[model samples]
Target: MQRMIEFPTAFWVSQYTIRFAFQEEISAENSRNVRLFRTFLQQALSADLLEVVASYATVTAYVKRKVALQPLREQWYAQQASIEVSVSHTPIQIPLCYDEEFALDMQRVMDYTGLAYEQIKQLHLAKVYRVYVIGFLPGFPYLGELAEALFVPRLAKPRQRVAASSVGIGGAQTGIYPLDSPGGWNIIGKTPLKLFQMQRAQPFLLDVGDCIQFYEITKAEFRQMEVNSY
Candidate 1:
């Protein structure tokens, strides 16, 4: 059985704004519930009625002033108990190059995790990662709960600046830097893919709840692909 808690009376911060919060106690055993809750919100509410955001364990919905809070809350409760979302299983494949030059923190990762280069590569490529959320940077998708064996902590001190297209892992999360910016995550590798291409109609490649996988590519292949524009 699923559970949901709701707030009523429309807690008003400003005259035009009201707040309602729900905490869905999702199972940690699997991330399926997280994905289901995301899809449910996308389906149940009209495009203008509410704005929904999902994290590893929680889903928060923000409704506009014109929308009725009570009905929205009730509908959310009903949807939580219903099993209806058919989430797509098609995983997006990303090509990565882990050459020492690209992997700025390769030795650090080896020292921290006590794993050889091949072991690290195997663990990273072995599992299918889930797109938990897209925040922190535009088009930057927070992926995983990487296999326990590959987990590593964030950098003790963050770099003043990190290059765009750099891939890194911190704690249970692994992500690619969508643009050049200050970052603290341990750099593992880099990808040439334009994750957030402003020229594209959609702009963002990965959306919330999408699945992702990474495959290793050679330096030569990376250069050729960079020129060829796959």
Candidate 2:
């Protein structure tokens, strides 16, 4: 049985921003709640609403003035009481290349998690991941809830550059670097899929509520697929 998702608590965080926080662990349900709340908030947006950030457990709205806050707050709760959080989600299959050339820190991750390379890759493919939020970088996704046995900590010294599309695991979460950037997550594999395309109608390929499934592929297959993308 599922517990009802009550309306989240909201408080004024700044003169022009208010944050609505949910009381639930990081799960697909909570992710849906955040997504729904964010979607609902957009309906009440005025010129005063400067920005909105929907995160794992909270939705923060930034407005132009304090006077514009109350009406938005009233609107949010009204929608919260009347809106439905759960929506159908489509699972996306992401092909991953776990070859040594792409998996820079696989050995280190294996050492830390006590998992063999095959075990690690197979385990990763077995579970469905939820897209909790898309932040930290353009089109960068923060997917969550890795199986506990595969949990690994971030590198003590962050790497100067983690190649784009490199799949990495940090603590209990797994994510892909949308573009080449410095990061500390343990690199386990690389995904050939284009997660972010600048010219596309929607710059981001995945949304907050979409599901992700990782599957293994050989280096040759990865190269073959890469050729087709261009």
Over all chains combined, what TM-score does candidate 2 have? Answer: 0.86
lDDT of 2 at 45: 70
TM-score for each predicted model, relative to the true structure: 0.80, 0.86
- Against the reference, the lDDT scores of all candidates come to 0.74, 0.82
- In the range 70-172, model 1's lDDT, one tens digit per residue, is 6766776676556433767678999898888889988889998899988888898887888877899897888886878767888889998998888999988
lDDT score, candidate 1, position 15: 47
* lDDT tens readout by residue for model 2, 1-230: 34445667888897888898996578777788888777777667756678788888898888787645566566765666455534557689899999999999999988988889989988888889998888888878888889888899899999999998899999889998988999999998898877887887777777776789888899999988877753
Off by over 4 Å in 1: 1-31, 73-86
The best candidate in terms of TM-score: 2
Those runs of model 2 whose alpha carbons end farther than 4 Å from true positions after fitting are 1-4, 46-48, 64-86
